[model samples]
Target: MALDRPTPVTFHAPMVLAVGLPPATLSRAGVVLEPSGVALRESNLLDLRSDSAKYRPLVLLVDAELYDFDPEAFDMVAQDVGAKLGVAGSAREAEVTLGQLMAALARKSAFPPPPSSADAKTDKWDFSEVVAAVAAQGGRE
Candidate 1:
């Protein structure tokens, strides 16, 4: 996917779209956006290290498109991890901290659908009721 629209954006799937560092330009990283949450490759950790040590602890961003993912699941994970690390007293606190990332995902997903080819070619595809037909096809999720 190009950086602009980032094709194959995996609207219904979780994926890490990009990463940024101060000295280095924003580069794409290979992180699996899973339904349960984001999974980071070992390499991603190394890249993150060049940024800030405080941010070294790898946390992930997640959304509905991710595989088997639910927002509440992450809160549970955060709570468990935080308990082990002796950070917040409960996972509910972690949930409050992750508000920004969660909000961003929600907004991004609300984007309008891309222009379909049907808009330009009348004979090729029909725009009217196309979404309904696709929904009926059942192949689309």
Candidate 2:
């Protein structure tokens, strides 16, 4: 008589793409699974814009202390790869951040983004308009 077992599925994504992180951060994140038994890959910002990404549902982690720490650039990277941003300020923080991102990507999770301010019909001057009206009414009663 024999028993059978299952194997880890080959996820569409390569799991993790770590950028500019300290060497010790990955393991400290304490992510427990290797869904594809595949380890992470190191990357540069330029690679993110390419059409050929290594995986799907990938987690992109970047260090805040990069030589040219530009928030806009990193945001663009995340957009190009259709990924959420995880910026770590230090070695310790990177570990915690890595763990958080890894947890979010696990178990085939699908989290839709929350509504954006663009959904509102209000204009950019709306707040100032309200302020003017309040001032016209003779300050707080």
Candidate 3:
């Protein structure tokens, strides 16, 4: 009889797909992102949605000059797709935007919410304080 084996899991790579940026810009962006453990790709505005769905990138850096530059709208789109959006006028700015997003995400996951008082099923023994008080009084006088 053959033993059962577990299936391998498929995890998405840490990626950044810069939308509407030229290949030349992307080449520089790639170099900037090399040490951050994130792979960078360039996708035109036409394929933005499809590429976004496929990559599920941490940051979708966009060239604001390509179209109407509405940061708020892009932010909503990013939030809808579960990623942080970055609009860049230059390659260096894009790098900074990505860095800020990375920092924000790191800070978010580093600290957990304080434990709720109601959820804690404290096993503290009742009358323990009273017992301590009696002992301090030297055998109840």
- Model 1 segments more than 4 A misplaced: 1-36, 40-98, 122-141
**Cα RMSD of predicted structure 3:** 6.8
lDDT of 1 at 87: 22
Give lDDT for model 1. 0.36
Residue runs of model 3 more than 4 Å from their true location after superposition: 1-8, 67-73, 102-141
Give the winner by lDDT: 1 or 3.
3
Give per-residue lDDT, candidate 1, residue 111.
100
For 36-129, candidate 2 gives per-residue lDDT tens digits of 3435666666765552255642556777777256878777766776767677666677666656655656644566667698877765678889
Error of 1 at 98 (Å): 4.4
For model 2, the run of ten residues with the poorest summed lDDT: 29-38
* Total backbone collisions for each predicted model: 7, 1, 0
Residue 58, candidate 2: alpha-carbon lDDT? 55
Against the hidden reference, what TM-scores do the models get?
0.22, 0.51, 0.63
- lDDT leaderboard ranking: 3, 2, 1
